[model samples]
Target: MSRRKVGLWYRLAAALTRPPMMMLFRRDWRGRHHIPATGGFMVVVNHNSSLDPVAYGHYQYSTGRVPRFLAKSSLFTNGAVGAMLRRTGQIPVPRGTKDVRDALKAAVSAVNGGEGVVFYPEGTLTRDPDLWPMAGRTGAARVALRTRCPVIPVAQWGAHRVLPPYQKKPRIFPRTTHQVLAGPALDLSSYYGRAVTPALLGEVTDVFMGAITDLLAEIRGEPAPAIRQRTGREHPHGLPSVSGRS
Candidate 1:
């Protein structure tokens, strides 16, 4: 099927699912209006739970952008859920591989084709007990730099409570509330058409993480976590590895 058709079907599915989901969450979702109506943009949010992508996808669809995601390839394996994901335009990246070049190309192309892509820089669900964002990978930054697309930092809170990581069942009894805050877009013009250095990439990644942390803190009515005092350096996760400039 064509990308347009896939997008249309996904939007319809979201419309049908959102009301019940929203009702289930009884979510007090706010700042959806802050999402850009038109343009190639990236929606960067913290990953807390498995339900997060669905919630964020619904929210982004409601905000007038059909979100295409970079999901783990494992989720796209042969299965009912995988079939559904295939139809919904979720691109899969193999876990723990340094070769997401195709996925990156697809993302950049989607944005250039005037679609929005939603990604989590943290790569995996938050390991933090508090569900605050951990250090982020540079995929989001790379995409933003390459496409020159606006990276809208989304701070999400409470989804973890709805369905905590590794829990087989969600708390569907008493409804839960989720908050999504859309921060201003990152400034990437400085690195436009130029290779992003390690220093530059780190700066951009930190900026995005800081914004998400601030948003989470705001929703939880608590202070953000203190920055690690280590000398700035890149850390490896199980996800694909890429150089700062690549």
Candidate 2:
């Protein structure tokens, strides 16, 4: 594919991020063709370490698509990091507030206008002791249902080795392997025009989370547990009920 129209800020951010990513991790990306070639779509990815987004973003950028992520509101505070995020089309979500729904509205608009948005369905890094994907909230389902965009489930592993959750020190010497996998756009037309009830959202959320867990299992060459580990702070339509988790 010849160069797709990616923004300068995205290019700059990738440039700034690539060296550190290169020095720290080896990438194993798969099933990228599952991503829509040229249209708006939603990617439901499991979150573990913060570093995984960089790996995931690299995978997206390499495929010639600049991902629009649902970023935490704090990253948008007035500053250079904030400026870079805004210029690159990331959506700032005031995660715990009632107004978090506004971020959903913005995502819907962007998808309808042909942009790929990435959603970390669990809203934060895994609280599962083993880093398995936890129960996800309804935002991913809400966005897909509202915009009727293709929801592609992406599963990733290995970035946590570079920087695990709840820890400040990163292991950079051994060169962690950041594995990412994407699957075909899920067929959710069955739920397209249904009422956006909690039950409906829950069902769709299951599909998204289930697919991610399956992918993570594949990457690790193991079986996902019948019951996903839960952090016990599930948010119906928002971030974690616990403060300072994301």
Candidate 3:
């Protein structure tokens, strides 16, 4: 399918999905104005629960932007779900591989076509049980560098509290409240047009992760675990640095 058709289908799906989602979470989104009214961009948000994408999707739809999410291939198993994802312009990524050339090309094309792409740099929901963002991976950085699009850091809290991770069921009697905060866009011009060295990539990833951590802290009313302090190194994946950097 063409990008135009995919985006149209995504918009329709989002419209249909948003209303019930709003009712389910009784969502209260703030700083939505921070999202640009028009343009290509990437939204890098912290992951806490499986519902994070749904919450963010609803929020993006409310802001008049149809979101294209990068999801794991496992979630696309169901025929209906896979069809919906395809119609909605979501990309499925194969895990545990460096072979993202195809996914990267698709992402770059989407951004260049003026679509909004949302991804979780952590790659999985937070395992800390407190829902704080874990150290980030570098996939988001690579995309950001490739597209040179504005990267908006979104901090989401209370979703995990709504439906905690590793639980088999969710509580539906009393709807949970969710808060979505959209922060300012990150600047990556310093490394643009240059070879993305390990140090440069780590620096860019830290910049994005720091913003996400700050937003999580704001929502939870407590500081998130410091990345450098806890791990003693940048980035969870430990991507090696090239010569003369890091």
Candidate 4:
């Protein structure tokens, strides 16, 4: 359970990205102690804005456990940005493809190798009009169950005020607060040693999503809605789901 050595590329990336993040948003990060101090783990997060990754990364990186994020495959095709991502050991997820075996294998291998892998299991940003967390895909659950690593449920809000989902412009003059809370690692002992099936994956994934939602509710100081939103489906408010290739 020794800490993974920080590579030069990660240091460089952090050096470049941290200052900008600090300038744009004030942070209210709690539960830092909940993050495994010395072990491989999975950090499951709810995605709202594009900037949350930077916010979450800064929070996690500040704790001295560098996380390898599962980012969009398109981001890996860019020139300089892509080079930095690859050099820093970020995983590229081929969104919407049935052929994610490679990415899944890489994630399992990373956790087994004692690296922290961050997963936005909802795949992409929540399509919920109320901005609550939506039902997620099973990628994180698969990795967690496969490695049985500590799965840290983290909830973050307030980034959307800086930059709304799918919007190109950021309202940066007035700095926003990035509120993130990391809950204790989820206990999946009952699921361990069980057969891995779609039903099992979905069940485990629900637990991950529920934990995240509860944390978010605490941050918002409001009760979460009774019904969770699912991507690609309409809900009671006549809100149509917006799909993303996360």
**Per-model TM against the reference:** 0.85, 0.90, 0.85, 0.93
Question: What are the lDDT figures for the candidates, one per model?
Answer: 0.74, 0.83, 0.75, 0.88
**Candidate structures ordered by TM-score, highest first:** 4, 2, 3, 1
Please give the lDDT score at residue 94 for candidate 3: 81
Residue 124 in candidate 4, Cα distance off native in Å: 0.7
How close is each model in CA RMSD to the real structure? 6.7, 4.9, 7.4, 3.7
Q: What lDDT tens digits, residue by residue, belong to model 2 across residues 1-246?
A: 212368688889999998888888788989989888787888999988877888899888887777889989999986998999888888999967998999999998888878888999988888776678998989989989888878899998887777776566877877767889998889998887778899999999999999999988989888877897654554344432222221
Best by TM-score: 4
CA-RMSD of model 3: 7.4
Write one digit per residue (lDDT tens) for candidate 1, span 175-219. Answer: 777778887887767767666888777877888888888878878
Candidate 3 residues 1-246, lDDT tens each? 122333567767766777767677876688888777777889999876777688888888778777889998777777877788877778888876765667777888888888888989877766553456677778889999998988999998666655665454765657777888899898788889888888888878888889988987777677666552232234353422221110
Candidate 3, which segments miss by more than 4 Å at Cα? 1-8, 228-246
Q: Between the candidate structures 1 and 3, which one is better when assessed by lDDT?
A: 3
Clashing pairs in 2: none
Error of 4 at 93 (Å): 0.8
Error of 2 at 104 (Å): 0.4
Which residue pairs overlap in candidate 3's backbone? none
Candidates sorted by lDDT, best first: 4, 2, 3, 1
